[model samples]
Target: MRKILIVGAGQSGLHLALGLRAHGYAVTLMSNRTPDEIRNGRVMSTQVMFHTALQHERDLGLGFWESQTPRLEGLGISVADPGHGRAVDWLGRLDHYAQSVDQRVKMAAWMETFAQRGGQLVIHGCAVSDIDYFADSYDLVLVAAGRGELVSMFGRDPARCAYGTPQRALAVAYVHGAEPRPEHPGVDAVRCNLVPGVGELFVIPALTVGGRADILFWEGVPGGPLDVFHGVTDPDDHLAVVLQLMEQFTPWEYARVLNVELTDPGGVLAGRFVPTVRRPVASLPGGGLALGVADVVVANDPVTGQGANSAAKCAAVYLEAILARGERPFDAEWMHATFEAYWEQARHVTKWTNTLLGPVPEHVERLFGAAGRLPQVADRIANGFDDPADFEDYFYDPERTDAYLARAAAASAWPGVRGARRIRGA
Candidate 1:
């Protein structure tokens, strides 16, 4: 069996590690944190998985919280006016539910399971310089560091990278006692409120350390009001500021979290990251190469919530490619080809995410406007979160968008759909 070393216990790295081990490959999963450390640590991410990604976990027998995690049945959007309250709002009901399971619980459980399955679990902090040692020992090294020294090893592919600087200063907090949706009390949808030029606020329901909780994610534009967290350590202080920001910008969300308390004393994460796309193969000092997986290769902004989903798909694709190689040597060529295959699927995700990060164009704005009343158009956009590749057929550019609008119009026979078909979706 070929030895595969996976660094970082993130969605991609751990998924591939476990998949390889199940298929009888020698796999080593290394991470800096233990189950106890991670479970008790500060919140790592507001990771919500769409239909396909959730299905991948189910197929891998990692559906540990499928029954407990809150269902994100809809994607709600409220375009807030600076002083006039909500200018426009609508809910896009997802055909299938998306779910968010706190990484603390998820990753810790995964680590414990990998160890039980006889996979080597190494708890050690790694660095860029450590790539050489890993490459020399394992037949192939997969880096899914998410963020750390291992990330720098993958040279930025300028052709693919969209931004030169951090797009949004992100702040996330996990809290219990948030008010449920007024209309559907039992439903926990991903409720997003956009303050046009300012930033975005998302309230995602997740299963955290204390069971089910809500994640308030703030994507503050540079120099914007939401860009408030600086050297903030106290969770109470963070939550207080988060509440203040929401009250000032998105008051409706403020009402939802009126008396909500932080889930953990340390459950606050704040920072900024430049969304980057890197070359899949990283060259070592001694001419060795390590393959990059998921975020290490393509890091998307959390605005679209594609980070975890894309990473899960990357693991699935790489596992299949490796198995198909059979007895072939794990050469540089094989690595490049394998990454290219994954990129074909990933490109759509990258493109869609990039489009959302920017300001909405006129044509796309109209689509959202129409979605307020049209169920078909709304559902397509909602379910698009699952298979972003479909956006290429309609949501990416003018010609395709027009084509999709036509189909949607003809299928509905509603005069409203006909008017929408005239203009394209972005």
Candidate 2:
């Protein structure tokens, strides 16, 4: 078996480790914490995965929450104006549903799952200097950790990175007793309350530590009133801050969480990180190279909810690249090519995410406005979250948007073309 070392046990690391292990590679996964520690530790993220990424998990037999987790059938998008109160809102249906499995539960189970699959799961915190020494032993080393000393191994690719500062100061909490939406009634879709000029509030149904629950994800725009959760250590305090923010801005959501409480003491987290992309290969002191994987290379803000999905796709793409290079050296050249393959898919995600994090373009805003009136438009936008590849056709630019709308309008006028070919970017 060709020896492989995977650093960090996040979604990408575990997915790749298990996939490689099943393929008969001698894989050793380095994690900072054991299963119990992870399960009881602070919540890492609100991973509300859409279908494309979810299918990847099921293919790997890692969809343990499929039965218990709530099925998000669509996206309930409401653009609330700060001056005008409630504006246009719609529940756009998705062809395939999405699901959110709390990382606390998911990561913990995966660590144990990787171990049971004959992969070595080492519970030790790692640093760059440590990896420099370990890279000599393994045939290939892959770093997938989201943050910490391990993350610093990869240098920023200035040409690809867009933002120099954090776009949003995020505050997230998992809780129970969040009432159903009065509009749709039931956890059928991820309700995203878009407060224009402020930020976003995502109420996602999830399988958490305390069974089925909702994750109230608050993305506060810089210097906004919604960015008030910093320094709140107590879970109760965190919950209170969230409630107050909702009551002040998104009152409709506040009504649903009237009786909501923390899922566990370890369920609330508040922090900020700028979205970044870095060089995939890190040069070690001894002239060896460690390949950066997932967030370590391409980290995006959660505004678009593409973090988890992109990470899952990265692992699968890399696995394909590795298998194709059969009996060949996993050299720096191979690492760069492998990342380029993943980047082909991930670039769409990063573009969509970065576009969303900044000021909304008029053409894109026109799509959002039209989605409320047109079911086809709504469904396409809803499903686009699942597969961002579709975005290259219409979601990114003004000319494409105009072309898509023009084509749809002309088709509607004649009733001759029910389906028109997508407009490719010029």
Tell me the whole-model lDDT of each prediction, alpha carbons only.
Answer: 0.84, 0.86
For residues 1-426, could you state the per-residue lDDT of candidate 1 as single tens digits? 799888899889889988998899999888999988998888888888999998888888988998998888888877887693887687777878999999889998999999999999999998767768777888888888878777888889999988999999999988999876775676668887888889999989988889989999999898888888988888899989998998888887888888899998868999999999998898888778889999999988998888899999999999999999888878899999999999998888889988888887666766676667666777777777888876766776766666665567556665544234233341
lDDT score at residue 338, model 2, on the 0-100 scale: 96
Q: Write the per-residue lDDT of candidate 2 for residues 1-426, one digit (tens) a residue.
A: 689999999999999998898789999999989999999899999888998899888888899979998888889788887653667687778778899999888999999999998999999899888888898899999999989887787899999999989999999989999877888885478988888888999988889988999899999898988888877888999989998888888888898899988999988999999899999999988888999999999999999898899999999999888778878899989999999999999998898899898878889888888767665667677778987878878888898898887765555444323223222322
The runs of at least 3 residues in candidate 2 whose Cα sits more than 4 Å from the true structure, single-residue gaps closed, are 409-426
Task: List TM-scores for all candidates, in order.
Answer: 0.94, 0.95
The whole-model C-alpha lDDT of candidate 2 against the native structure comes to: 0.86
- Return the lDDT, model 2, position 34: 95
User: Which of the numbered candidates is closest to the native, going by highest TM-score?
Assistant: 2
Please count the clashing residue pairs in each candidate, in the order shown: 0, 0
Error (Å) of candidate 1 at residue 421 is 13
